[model samples]
Target: MLRSRDDKKTQRQKSEVWPMAKAHVYQRDHINTDEIIPARYLNTDKEAELAKHCMEDLDAGFVKKAKAGDVIVAGDDFGCGSSREHAVWAIRGAKVQTVIARSFARIFYRNAINCGFYLIESADAVDKIKDGDEIEIDYDAGVIKDETSKTKIQFMPLPDFALEIIRDGGLLDHIMKTSA
Candidate 1:
């Protein structure tokens, strides 16, 4: 008896499961920080509070739709606003596992890594993925699989050091863990 390809994949994944994510796509570019958390909500750096308002300005329904281990899919310049760490904080607060975009703002990229948030720049993922699509990301393999569509794409994963920081829960945590 021969198993189908997807069945084979399922069997393999059962042994080495990747993080599963649900895609929450925003079809626009330049989703700035202000829209991510709104400066007015920046008073307290509490992640839980910030989570309540994440993406409120840009998409009022976002908070309602988002869940832990979900993914944000967007076009280029996905964090292209003022240099505000709050942006990444809010996203993390919302329990979003990672973001897939065509590109990212330089500062936001750094801040995200520092915050232990994952961000992948993949044009194919952005273009092919859609809202509500169930996705799985293999960090080691650098692959994004759309479970809904049953397709996948490959991209370069972050370097080992950055992955270490993310795995340790940001630079500060990484430092504390390694230096202790």
Candidate 2:
């Protein structure tokens, strides 16, 4: 749900608000996992170091200030590269909770879920959403609201099963819970 600017102001004025510290806007399609976290970093077994280089080209300073629960808004084909699970691992390792994009590479999408990363797709949502926009995503409602723009964007809702898996931390955890 993308909210209008006025709506965002209203929301902020009402109470405590968390604003995005950084925003990365990409113009191209098919930004693969390599771009998100370069292959060279893969040599290191530690995710902490690997995530430090994530999206180095896109945002060199991201690793320094990015917290565990930051949100990433990207354009079409956001994760279109290799089938490396390390890519997903690095993102999760960085502690990013959600990724909103126009479209995603099939493998990347599934890999993200398997690693407990929430991925949402919204065609024009990325365009309308700017960097640092105080936004709220309602996973159950399939909406992304931009408090700054006061714009609301609708996205495809995650299937209940998928949500369940994510809610449980990942497929492995989900399986363990059900098996028990």
Look at candidate 1 and tell me the lDDT of residue 14.
17
Give the alpha carbon lDDT tens digit for every residue of 45-104 in model 1. Answer: 777788899999999999898877788899999898889887877787777777899999
Cα lDDT computed for each candidate against the true fold: 0.80, 0.68
Compute each candidate's TM-score over C-alphas.
0.84, 0.78
Instruction: Show where candidate 1 strays beyond 4 Å.
Output: 1-20, 176-180
Q: Where in model 2 is the C-alpha error above 4 Å?
A: 1-23, 65-68
Candidate 2 C-alpha lDDT tens digits along 10-122 = 12211322354233446567778878888777776466666678777667787676774567778788888888876766665666656778888899999877655668887
Worst 10 residues of 1 by lDDT: 2-11
TM-score of decoy 2: 0.78
After the best TM-score superposition of candidate 1, give how far the Cα of residue 61 lies from its true spot, in angstroms: 0.6
Error of 2 at 81 (Å): 1.7
* Candidate 2 weakest lDDT stretch, 10 residues: 3-12
